[model samples]
Target: MTELVSTTPGLYPLPDWAKQDLSDLKGHQKHDLISGDEGPEIVDVYDRAREEVVSEQVDAGLDRIVEGQLRWDDMLAHPLTVHENVETGGIVRYYDNNNFYRDPQVKGELTFSGDVAAELDATSELLDDEALQAVLPGPYTLAELATNEYYDDDAAFLDAVGEFLAGEVDAFPEHETLFLLEPSLVTDAPDEDLDERVPDAIDRIVDATDADVVVQSYWGALEEKVYAHLMDANVDALGFDFVAGDRDQTLYNINEYGTKDDIALGLVNGQNTLVESPETVHERVEWTLDRIANKSFDRAYVTTNTELFYLPENRATEKLTALAEIANIPEVKA
Candidate 1:
C-alpha cells in the first residue's frame, strides 16, 4: 500500500513572540545569536519557540515532524557563516525572492563541530524516533551558494563541504528522514560535469546515516540532465517544487527518468498568503499521482513547495493543517 504522509520540507516561520524578542536585540547581540553564543534570554526564546513549533505540527496531525528550524538565520548559508574558518561577506539575494542571506567566504578547509547536529539532538528530546525528520542544505547547493576562496578546484571544495555535512549527520540523534535541500540544481544549473561530480559528493554526505535521505529541490524543477544524474545517487527520493516550478516538466522528468520507492510532492504553495483548502490540496495531490501513475512508490510525502517562513505564522499553520488533512483523504490515501 502507498502510505501518504504530511510534513514541512524546510524551516517553519518564527512565531511573533520570538520575532519580537529578536527585534529587541542590538546588532552585535544578533551576531552572537547566529554564532550559537546567544545570551540566556535568546536561548530561552529558542527553547520555548522550538517546543511550541513542534507542538503545532503534532496538534495539526502531521505524520512526520520537522524541528521547525527556528534557529536558522538563513537556510543554505547559515552553517557556513557560523563556522570560525569562514568569513561573512555582503548579502546575496536568495534565489528570485526578496529574502537575502550573507555570503560565506571560505578561508580554509571546512570542518564541522556538529552545531546543526546538536540542534537536532535538542529537538529529538521532544519527539519520538518515528516522527522526527532532520533537515539541512545539500552539499551541492551549499558549495554553489558560498564563495570558496580555500580549495583549488570546485570538486575539492564540494568534497570538503560534503565531509563537513557528513560529520553533522554522524552526530545527529535518531531521525526517520533527512531532507537535503538542493534548490541550486534548478536555480543555477551546474556544468556538464554534474554526472561526474554530484553523485559522489552526495554519497559522502549520506554514507554515515541510515535515515531515509531525500534530495529536495525547489524554485523550479531540475533540467533533464540534472534530474537524470541526481536519480543515479543513493538517495531514497527526489523532491520537486510543484507550486513555484513548472509542474509539467517535473512530472515529465519523473515519468521519463523514473524515481525511487519514496517521493515528496510539494502540493502546498509555501510563499503564498492565500491558504489552500484541504480539498484543493487533495485535488493537486491526485493530479500529480495520476500523472506519475506508471511509477511505484511505497511512501509519498505531501509538503509545501518552499519554506514556510515567507508566509505569516497564522497562514503557515493553516497550510500545515491543510496538508495533514489532504494526506488522510480517502482518494489520496488509497
Candidate 2:
C-alpha cells in the first residue's frame, strides 16, 4: 500500500507582485484558474506570474503544497452553474470586485468541471519538481454557495456538484494530494435522532474519488458525534483547523481513522499577515505528534486552516516552510 503522505492545503495567495498580476487580470482574461469576485478565471498557472509564487512555495520547503491557488478567486467569481441539468452562463456577484455571492436563489451553468480538470493537469505540471496537494472546494461548500434558481435546498446543489467533481477527480492520480475544503461539513451534521442530510452528501462526494480524499473542516468543530462519523468515513484524511477551530482533543481521536487515513493539523494562520514562528510550530507539532501516536496514526500533515490569500507573502512562506519541516519530523514515542 502507498504510504499516506503529508501536505499543506492550497490557496496561500500570491505576493505583492503576483497579487498585482491577479488584480490586473482584465484582458486575455483568466477564468477558473483562481476564483474571484465574479466568474472564475480559467487561466493556466504556468502562464501567470502567480506561477512564480507557486514555484517559490515548493522551493521554500513544502513537501507538498499548492500552486498558491493563483486563480481561485477568479474561479469562485464564475463558480459552476447548472440549471435543470442544463448549462447556462454563470451566477456572479460583486463585493467591490471581490466575488462574494452564494445566494441559492438562482441557477447558472455548471461547466467548470472540464476547466477544473484541465487546470489540475496544469497544476500537476507546475509542481512537476515537487509533490503537490491540489485543492477543490467541497461540493457541500460550493452547493451552499450556489445561486439556486430552481433548486429547493442545499442538498440538491451539493449532489449535482458532487457528481461533477467526482468526474473531475477520476481524471488523475498524480496530484497525490487532494484536500476537499468542507470547512463546515463536520460542524453542520445533525444529531443521530435527526437527519443531518449532509453526511450522506459528503459520502456521495467522497465515494466517487480515486484520489485520497481529505475531508477538511475549519471554522468550528461541531458536536462530538459529527467528527466521530467523519473519522469513520471512507475518506483518506481528516484536516483539523487548529488555527481557527477549538478542536484540541480531536487529535486524540486519531485511532478511529483507517490505515490509509491521514490527519492534517492546520497550524499556520492563513487569513492574516501575522507570521507564525517556527519554534511555536515545533512545540505544537510535539503535542500533535503525541496525540496521534497515542491513536496509532503513522501519517499526519500540517497546513494553514484556510487559503493564504489573506496573508502577506513573507509570512506565508515562513509558515509553509515550517510545516514542511514538521512533516519530516520524526514520530514521538510513548
Candidate 3:
C-alpha cells in the first residue's frame, strides 16, 4: 500500500480543473437538463462523457483529490442506462445524451471495460502518494434511478440491482477507497424496511469489491440502527455532511459512537460559495482533532459534503487549489 499524507485540516478548496470542466461543459450541461422535480439536469451523464471530464480532472494536476464528479446527464444519475421504460431509463426531455441517459438503467453488460477502467487507473496514478478516492452511487440512489425501471416490486429490484451494481464496482478499476453516496439514506422511508436492507445492500457491494470502502451519507442524520450497522461493516471510513445534517454539535456522542473507527469529518459546504477562511477551517479541524486527542488519524479526514457543482468553474479551482496547499502544508511547531 502506498502511503498517503493528510492535508492536516485547513481551508483547501475544490480543484481548479473542476471549474474548467464545468465551464467547458456548462453549455453542454445546461442543454442536458431534464429537470426532475427534485432539481436540475446537472446530474446527468453523456455516454463516454467521463472520458473527457476525467481526463481534464487528471490533467488539472490537483493532487490529493478527485474531480467533483462525472455521471448521469440527468443531474446526478450514473451507471444508469437509457431505455424507454422510465424505471430503467426515461426521456425527461430536459437532457441529451449520446444516448447513455436515454437508457437510465444499466444494460446487458454489468462490467466496465479495460478502456474505461484504464482511464480511472490513469487518474489514480496521478494521485502521487495520495490514495485515489472515487464515488459509487449508493444503492438507494441507484434505486431512485429505478424510478423508471417500473419494477412490480421496488424492494426486490433494489436487491437484484444491488447485486448487479456490486458487480460494477468489482469491475471498476481504482485504488484508495471508493465512496458509496447514499444521501437519501440520511432519512428513512415509512413504507420500506430500510433498517435491514440498506446496509445489507451495502454489504453486498463490499463483498463484491476489492477496494477499501467508505459508506457516505448526507442531507440528514442517519438512524441509530443504520449507524450501528455501518460500524459493523468494517469499512475504511464513514462520511457525513456536517453542514446539512447540522446537529447541535457533539453529534458522535448522541449515538454513543466513539472514535474507534475511521470517519471523514465533512465540515465544508458544497451548496454555498462563501469560501470558508483558512483559519476557520483550521479551527474546526483542530476541534475535531482534539476530540480524538489528535490521535494520528484512525483514517480521519475533512470533506466538501457535496460537490460545488453549482459553483462556477474558476471559483471551484481556486477552492480546490487552496485545499491542496493546506493539505501539503508543513506542520508548524508551537
Assess candidate 2 and give its TM-score to the true structure: 0.76
Write the residue-wise lDDT of candidate 2 on 53-108 in tens digits. Answer: 66776776776756555545433322353223333344454222354432333444
Candidate 1 global TM-score: 0.95
lDDT string for model 3 (175-211, tens) is 5666677665664431346446666777788887677
Candidate 2: deviation at residue 316, Å?
1.2
Clashes of each: 0, 47, 41
- Score candidate 2 by lDDT: 0.57
Model 1 CA lDDT for position 22: 76
Q: Which portions of model 1 miss their true places by more than 4 Å?
A: 27-33, 128-130, 331-334
Top-lDDT candidate index: 1
Q: Which ten-residue region of model 3 has the weakest summed lDDT? A: 1-10
**Model 3 regions lying over 4 Å from their true place:** 1-63, 82-130, 148-152, 187-192, 249-255, 291-297, 328-334
Tens digits of per-residue lDDT, candidate 1, 53-154, equal 888888888988888877777666788888888988887888888877788899987877677887888888888544889888888899988999999888
